[model samples]
Target: MSNTPSLTANLRSDLPAALVVFFVALPLCLGIALASGAPAFSGLIAGIIGGIVVGALSGSQIGVSGPAAGLAAIVLTAIGSLGFENFLVAVVLGGLIQVGFGLLRAGVIGYYFPSSVIKGMLTGIGLIIILKQIPHFLGYDADYEGDQSFWQVDGENTFTEIINALGNPSVGATTVGFIALGILLLWSNVLSNKGKIFTLIQGPLVAVAAGILYYVLTQGNPTWGVAPEHLVRVPVPKSFDDFLGQFTFPNFGAITNPTIWVTAFTIALVASLETLLCVEATDKLDPAQRVTPTNRELIAQGSGNILSGLIGGLPITQVIVRSSANIQSGGKTKMAAIIHGVFLLLSVIAVPTLLNKIPLAVLAAVLLIVGYKLANPATVSAIYRSGWKQFGPYIVTVLAIVFTDLLTGIALGLVVAIIIILYKSYQNSHFLHRVDSDDAAGRHHVQMQLAEEVTFFNKAAILRELDGLPEGAILELDVRKTRYLDYDIVEILENFATKARDRGIDIEIIAVGKRVMNPPSYMKFFDLAPAVEGH
Candidate 1:
């Protein structure tokens, strides 16, 4: 195993990456909070805590933490039921519960999830990103931005929301959004080819800058300019003291509320699952293929959430949006994560007015591009070529997310994946046993025949026959017709071989080939010999 990189070197490499992450995280922080029915300032608080606290404690090198869209539905419901102030209490408690989970080392739960389910989750989330962002891209503010559920707020569901948004479009916002998107695409392709300037400035930054400049030029003209409704409104804190005063304390009195407890538990469970899933996905994207410590990540997330909630912020987690951006930006350490947090804090305090100048339409364009990258056609094609087992779950997950909400869609996809795994297990093989009585000397003969492929799934039946065999009986294992055997099954056979010898039973392994019988002692019977003459 390679030793952990030095902290000084890690920090140096992460600073520049963190600057990139800050740009990515800023709009998402505000957008998610706006979508979750929480105060926009609260989202900034969560981002700051996630970066400064979570990033400091996290074991993951590249995963950036912040308020997630996955928790939007839950937060909206919790606030409606418990009231915003009371909900803050639940958020704080949820962070505490997450801390407890980390101390208990519950992060291993992430590893138990099947690969199919995980892939489904990624695809589902990608589709959700695309679906939820479409309204924003079109400049329709009917629903809160970042709402991923198929259902919309106007009493209409997902389908209705689309219809309504299409019927009543904000032409000004739409035009600006498209213009910004065009600029981004052009910048990514043409401008990037020019030199160092394009290399240093990303497409998103360019889009945002152009949108701000456009807004500045058209500020006096109502018809041509972007409206206040379509712009990002960051809370303006007059002074350093005023900025510090924006932080709210959790209402600890709500601790006794049963609803609060339920909300806390829900946040803990969902956030942990999301974090683990993101961690796994991040590892796959890592060029070095390093595995993060899942348990440690939970602890870091827990601490970050605690700080966020204590300061009257939303729940926090390892958000894939920022993490993907971090990786794509060449972030190599946790320092990038910490720096992003610092930028969030500074932007809100020192430059809140400048940030507000950036039009929402431009931000929408940035998100649309991000969503497109996530749900790219190439990704879908790659998943399809991996086979139905992979593609089936992937497609189901995407559809579910597009049709429903994040958690529900993931659950449904997971159920489908489990069913597929079980079906594959059943198709692998059958087990059979035979016993015959010989007239001469009253001897008995026992035989066990395995199908072409025997896996760990059939261990119970094999073990039962081996244990039930009578002493002094002649035992025979017929593998001549078997084509493949799982390694786990072979180990069981090897153990049984040792026990049978001690029991004085006559044991024979039929059709052992010179090459096949040479299996390592740990996996003696797992070998597949060439087919012998006759059945």
Candidate 2:
């Protein structure tokens, strides 16, 4: 798929989308860093690398890469075991491993997944976004902002956090959140169409500005004051040198430790999987329906992670949240992603203090819209209409993601989909047509045509049909359409031929080479064909 968006063709569309993605990505960078128990500046570094480096290299038009919430737990544990400095070594090694994965073309694994599971993943992540954002929206900011797992980094599960937030809502934050949500809704559904200025000046930026205004105005009103914790918390550097000092380099001296290698491999595996999955989902979400080069994406992510670790940053992945936000915000090119990275860098250097004043609730409002679009009820209804065969894996994936985590949920959904495939294979091994007319020899004709693939799964079904045949019947078994015939199935057919002879039933085999009447050995009939050149 063509992902090369000409600079002139997409500037107008990409600019506003880039701004929206910047606003969305800023807090997530900080939150995911906090959740990972790393320096807050690390997340920003990763975001910068993911956006500029990965965005420039990736074939994806809308996919946004950054520090992912799904890897927070692993980062936290690794930091505890290896210490922060040494852990950076693992991160760098992981990046190299990812680069190796890309070179090896392991990205093809993404295509093996069923469509039901992919849809389920998208819907599940959408629900997760909405569910995880509630507390932040209500001003209960105990948990980190980008926490997507059911069990949060703050020791609270998804539902329990909402329950707690309901009992302790911040009037100031709630008010700002509602107003921002209103602006977003109005901008998307009404104002954007009425004028180009509204489109250029995206609703998210307006909402954030409004949120900052509210925070400044209500600082002293006890009942309405937005607390420090309820706002964006970017680290403010006092001077140029202080800003430079925030970057922490890896302790490469510890690279020889076996534990470091193991950790590196773990990060590489999980991060690659997450990146591939996001590539598939982001491709599906793109308006142009352009397909991303998965192998190139892995290389891009690896390069980003390596750069991020060299200076101080969390591991990188193609994050669905920011990607979905970019898509929903009208981002049409990789330019949007590249520009968002530039915004992140400029924000850190130029206006961090101003950013810190914006309320988290406003960002939550932006995400709520993104979440709703991804998990639209219309999508669910349409999938349901496709029948249980399609809906089962989709719903399972959705629920599992809600209750567990993204990777685990997809694994479970795949298991269900595979089981369904096997069951269908068992039921559809062959087609049968029996003519009721009796010949002069008092025999009925039965024709059985095999399916494309007759594996061991079909043995039982084929055997049952053969055993039920009448004594005075002429059976014509057709294998011309079969691409693969398992040894188990072939043996079943050979045994059935012997039983047919005893029952006074005539057997005819219609195979690739020729038709045979009551062949002494079915294996010999298959063996007579020339072997494939390669095998």
Which candidate comes out best when scored by TM-score? 2
Q: What is the TM-score of each candidate against the true structure?
A: 0.79, 0.96
lDDT for each residue of candidate 2 in 284-341, tens digit (9 for 90 to 100): 8888999999999999999998999999899999999999999998899899999999
Worst 10 residues of 2 by lDDT: 526-535
Candidate 2 residue 276 C-alpha distance from true site, Å:
0.9
What RMSD does model 2 have?
Answer: 1.9
Candidate 1's displacement at residue 154, Å, is 3.8
Q: Clashing residue pairs in candidate 1, if any?
A: 150-158
List per-candidate RMSD values in Å: 8.2, 1.9
lDDT of each: 0.76, 0.91
